[model samples]
Target: MRELHEHTTTTAADALGEAEVAVLPTGSVEQHGPALPLGTDLFAAAGVATRVDRADAIVLPGVPVGVSDHHRQFHGTLSTTEETFADYVADIVESVAAHGVRKVVVVNGHGGNTNALRRAARRLRADDVAFTVPWHWWDNLDDLIDARLDTSLGHADAVETSAMLHLTELVQEDLLADAEAGAADSWGREVPGGADVGFDTADFSDSGAVGHPTDGTAEIGAELVAEAVDDLNALVDWLAAQRFEDLRPAPHR
Candidate 1:
């Protein structure tokens, strides 16, 4: 892994020069429920980022906190304002661009960080500082997840629990049943008029989980990670082959 932090100034200068793309992992350090660790998202993002075994890409240190105010009712949840998160991400990309590596892939692991990542990517592209693409680890895996767990994605649920199981040893296996028992059937609450009423995780989920946690297994988690890694590598290859100038905004018509 060409991890930026592992390299000294001289080595990094050489590595950066040879690197065609940079990979930045971003995630939230928030409550995942009793069964899962608070660093689940960060670990997932960083795990996938480091697994990209390509010499053309340089992995940046991960950002461990994100826009997670909705989960604040739960313990150990840390959050930053959307604006702050966006600016912070943009700043990092800008700095990377200063090194002449302008193509970047942001491997994201939290749903709440979506807007901020998008905002940051857009700003970077608009400023011509970098060409950034934000990617979720679970992207393009709906079929595999559905086949294995028969459910959609949820916070600290089977999908995420499986990922944690595959990637780390921090899962509290004994608490999986309790987490599922208190989990909400779905993500949010809605009224008769199609108005969504659920504002916070506390409003809908009793355990801060949204799906069946007990259904998660290490086997499925491994599959998820493998597929994600394959997708990431393909993306990196595509990015590496492109000229940076061609990825930037087109001249106004």
Candidate 2:
């Protein structure tokens, strides 16, 4: 197949009689921090998807808008209701699978998008299309993510900022300052900046970061990204190894 996330080209692999995995980058156009773009979620996911495509997948256009209702407090943020987002994901997966492609992978960014991934996964499986999605920050690379933090960093913390810095050099100085100041008062929890600052979004973090951004560095961010890609490849390889018998659904009986 041509690739997971690339422009769909039917004949690309028609002669092979095997479908290649199609990867969709799921992300959001929401507030990240004072320094980053409103497209951080999409950008981050696309970054990984790009790498995955080069390595083994056919990368598709990224779904830039997502269910980011929690981040609606920020001006540039765009969100769809969960139902709507779920519908969009299903439609895309179904459309691609309709073309004789069955393996679909969604390289996701944005913590807010995980719920949609789960809902979409269950839905895709029900429809008989094999689908898998990385749960943004936690899929397959827990060690790398945790290595960059001391405690659980809250929003806009060291890990995120560092990743942004490493990935795109898109860090914002003023916002980082704001995030740090708020972290001190909010008890080190700040979910993503540019949106509203409130108790609901504030509950999980004190200064806005549940973990430590103090230790985040570009080197760590790059390493984490690499590890994430490796984990994703491993998943693809494992899936490819399964045969019809290997995937047999368990009998309810």
Give the lDDT of residue 72 in candidate 1. Answer: 97
Task: Kindly provide the TM-score of model 2 when superposed on the true structure, using C-alpha atoms.
Answer: 0.79
Candidate 1 TM-score versus the reference: 0.98
Worst 10 residues of 1 by lDDT: 47-56
Write model 1 residue lDDT over 1-253, tens digit each, in one string.
Answer: 7699999999999999999999999999998989999999999999889999877999999999999999999999999999999999999999988999999999999999999999999989988899999999899889999999999898999999999999999999999998988899998899999998999999999899999999999899999999999999999999999998899889999
Runs in model 2 with CA error above 4 Å?
Answer: 1-19, 53-56, 184-199, 202-215, 244-248
lDDT of each: 0.93, 0.63
Best model per lDDT: 1
What TM-score fits each model? 0.98, 0.79
RMSD to true structure for each model, in Å? 0.8, 5.1
Clashing pairs counted in every model: 0, 42
Candidate 2 worst ten-residue window by lDDT? 181-190
Residue-wise C-alpha lDDT for candidate 2, range 165-221, written one tens digit per residue:
678867765566555554532332345764544543444433333334455577877
